[model samples]
Target: MTRWTQAAVLARMRQEIEASAPDPGDRLPTERALAAAIGCSRQTLRAALARLEAEGEIWRRHGQGTFRGRAPLGHPVRETVRLQAATPEQLMQARLLIEPAIAAEAARRASRSDAQYLLRLVEDGRVATSRGGAEEADARFHRGVAEVAANPILIGLLDHLADARRRAAWQREWDRTYRRIGVGEFVGLHSDQHQSVVTGIAEGNADVAEQAMRAHLLTIATAMRRGSDPADPGL
Candidate 1:
């Protein structure tokens, strides 16, 4: 019997692709068909496909078959269903990995207009008339920072994160955490962190901007993750 492992399947799959001369954005065969052609089980073929997707040799749409190359123009860049179900901790980890770098980039690219916009956003978030208003302003502030970075890829990532926040599960956890924190704590803690981040951006200080953004995200993660897992250490 042949040991048709994931790596072996991946090799066969690549040979097929090379033979076919797959064009960018061309649709690949379905997993079952591909597996049959490659003489492998569906599970092994799936593992190989995941590697290809991560390497940008292919991309997947939720309901569509995998396609060659990066995501097509105007199509969803990521599988939105995953983000739609991500827990607060998962989102926090993603934000920690992504947003701090964008904050630093925004600092490096800061213009007079960018500084003014960030400052205005900070003030709006600070003085929001109600809890809902404050949350909206906070969302805008983060989105504005990604915009100031001036990178379409970074902006797209933040846009996906925003969509995640609108999902029912994410929103429920967010609302619970916000209620626990209360408006006074938001004004005292989170608002101050926002001011610090914008100040770093306005000053074009990349180090300060990154640090402030990381700290801000940490504070939020701590609040949302609290009691969800008693052993999580709330980091």
Candidate 2:
């Protein structure tokens, strides 16, 4: 019998599914059965499944079991999905590395029009009535700052990072965070953070913009990590 590590288990599971070639909506075995067959604990199996879901290889409905996903994209950029099987902390780290520099560049290069557009997004976020509305405004604000940087490569990288945010796991994190912190409070905190970032950019202060962007992301990342179980490797 072969000892199965997490990566090996994940790979083998993918291979099994591909070889079976289930129809698009076909359901897989129950999690327990799958774990037993794969020679992994249920916890390990769940992590592998989550990664596959993130990669668009499968989809899971809450009450229903997992089902086969649409065919993978033929675009060469499928590599991006494979490279980004990141936890919440890892995604936050990537943003911390990427956004601060974009903020600084936007400060230097942003036109008055760019500043106004960002300010509008900040205001939109502040007044947003629902969580989804606020999240969209926040995304637009960050992506707008990246746009102001006028570097297509940076813009594309940020676009990929933003796409990662739409993953089901990240939504679970936000929902968990909201349950821990009241929804109103969560929205208010994010609004204030967005305001600070907009102010820094409007002032055309690169250092200040970078600092604000870093601080904003750090605050959310810390809150998210705190809300998560310390022992959960999936986090």
The most accurate candidate by TM-score is 2
Instruction: List ranges where model 2 is wrong by over 4 Å.
Output: 1-71, 74-78, 230-235
Residue 29 lDDT, candidate 1, scale 0-100: 72
Per-residue lDDT of candidate 1, residues 117-186 (tens digit): 9889888877877788888888898999999999999999998887767655566677777667677666
Candidate 2 per-residue lDDT over residues 164-210, each given as its tens digit:
67655576777777666655754687778877877888889999899
Q: Against the hidden reference, what TM-scores do the models get? A: 0.64, 0.68
TM-score result, candidate 1: 0.64
TM-score of 2: 0.68
